[model samples]
Target: MVTTGHWIDSSWKLQKRVLSFVHIPPPRRGVEISDAIFKCLKEWGIENKIFTISVDNASNNDVAIRLLKDTFSMSKNLVCAGKLFHVRCCAHILNLMVQDGLSQIVDITDNIRESIEFVNRSDGRLLLFADIFKKVFPRFRDREPHYDCCPSEEDWVKVVKVCNILETFWATTQIISGSDYPTSNLFLQEIKRVKLVLDNGVNDEDDFIRAMVRKMKTKFDKHWGECNLLMAVAAILDPRQKMKAVEFYFPQLFPSNEAQENISKVTTVLFEFYDEYVAANDHDH
Candidate 1:
């Protein structure tokens, strides 16, 4: 689905970014979506001006990136026209952490599903849970906390914060218990286990919940130089005035830790090298 997304400029200002959004039709072909994007970009002359194209490393996205690079060569007017295209998203990294944490056990996924199903099946229980939830989380009184069976948002809600997750599960437990459900305790225990995995498997923390968070933050911090796109988007969502630099570097952030660090170091070296080269060139003149 082609949904609208924005970008920020150097001033940490929100501005419209994406010109064209394309979606691949079912029974996807590698060439179709790319051709469409390239054709649109070419016609719009964005390809000529674009210095980089950020995309995922999924097979199709990789193909699209390669095709885009080959079809649109460097333009004299565009800086770093042939430079590497970064594939990244901070939310995607958080998604990986959550997935990794959950993957350590098979039953957790099933239990999560079961917990949601149990509440959703009966209108009485659902309403009761909603009522109990209101007492636990009055902030959500505006809308019912319908547990998403499958989270399919553009940026899947980053549930990296263990405390927030535990609070959510605890609230649901309250609702489930209020409904007199036998599986409430089981659901609670499973949620605890999820937290444990995130703590131990994900990282070492005195408090499992806090440890997972620290680890995730450390991981995110390691790529801050490049993964600024995520912070920019986050800042935009919060309408924060800071993180302007992050917006500036948004296009260069990638998900891989080693890759991001290497790119960041190279970027630093290149900037210094360019400054020296410019000074020497001026002296020669």
Candidate 2:
């Protein structure tokens, strides 16, 4: 399905609606996907207005964007260079990092997942589990009972801790993926929170949590070790944050020696973009 959306400046609202759903049966290649996207954009008469396309972390998506960039370069109406057109989905990247941490306690989660499936699959099993649940904890005997396969105290404790750790990531994903608001400016702050949580988790007293966080940190660094320029620019442009956000977060994001250098680069790039915007407006006037 193809969807087109834009932010409304006056109201500060995002309006997303489906534009088309092109069907290309079987073995979908990057070129085919890009072709479909272009077709949809052309039909909507917004082909030249393209800014960024957010996609999950899939190798094929890289190829698809490359093909799209080539198409845009050939269009006389293209507004900007196509190098800035592809946005890696932040939610998907966060999921990948959390999944890496979950892998460390796969046995516990697998058992829980299987137990949920078993109870949900059969009415008889569900009823039996509910009965057992009420018997174990009679405080809410009058209420409907929810059941899960019981884990040992130790395993359950670990499960709770893991959930607590991942809850922050899950919440941040929801915030950034919201369709009602501009999320780009929020990227740096949310990512910084995730990194801080992981760093703290690494030093946790629980050996299991420490080990899990270590695995997660490795994945987090792999994906987000370097800050994306777009996110940096967005954060800088936000009135409430401006350069203060960069100054506060960059030191944590990069080595202390390199933080100031990175901040300078972002400032230079923001000025370049501002100059282009002003020049375009002058031409229009």
Candidate 3:
């Protein structure tokens, strides 16, 4: 299924509507995907109004966008080329990173999942587990336990620490995935928080947490080491933040020397985009 949306009003909320939901059998090729998207746009009579396309972090998506760019080139639209036309789904990238981190504690997760399944399979099992829980903790005999199985104190401590670390990622993901608000400009700030969480976790006393965070950091760096230009431009254009946000965050995002060079490059690009917009508007007028 393919869907399309646009930012609505000054508040920048996504107003999404379904475009196509045809069942296309795999193995799906880049050309086929591009053709479907192009066909949909043409049908909607908005082929020339193409802007950024957000897609999951799949290798075939890269190819699909390249094909889409070629298709767009046939039109007179000048801005439908290069990085300006491609915006990767940040939520997908975050999911990949979190999954990588979670893999380190798969055994614990599997055990928990299995225990839940066991208890949920039958009412008898649940009653038995609850009875055992009351016997195990006499102080809590007056109250019913929410869960059937109780984890060991050590296991419980580890779970709490893990949840605390993951809570940051979970919250950030929710913010970025908001369809009711602008996410592009907010990406840099949220991602910086994610990096901070990972950095802090790396120094944790618990070896398990540090190891998990180290793995996640590797994946995070692989996907988002350098900030994307679309995100930078969006942040720059926001009246509340403007360029100060970039100036404040880029130093931490890059090495001391590279930070200055990146800022200069980003500023140059921003101006170039501004010039293009001005020239286009003048021509339209």
What lDDT score is found at residue 191 in candidate 1? 33
Q: Each prediction's TM-score against the native?
A: 0.46, 0.85, 0.88
Tens-digit per-residue lDDT, 1-285, candidate 1: 242234456987655545666666775555776787767767665565554554533567667767766666533432334443443432344454554434433243464465567577889767766777633223222244654333222112223343454454345445433322222123222333334443453453435445545554454454343323222322333333333433333333333555546446445544554565486479656
Candidate 2 collision pairs: none
Winning model by TM-score: 3
Best by lDDT: 2
TM-score of 1: 0.46
> In model 2, how large is the Cα lDDT of residue 152?
54
lDDT per residue (tens digit) for residues 120-154 in model 2:
78787667667776443222222335544445567
Whole-model lDDT per candidate? 0.46, 0.79, 0.79
RMSD of 1: 14.2
Ten-residue region with minimum lDDT total, candidate 3: 135-144
Candidate 3 pairs with clashing backbones: none
Number of backbone-clashing residue pairs for each candidate, in the order shown: 1, 0, 0
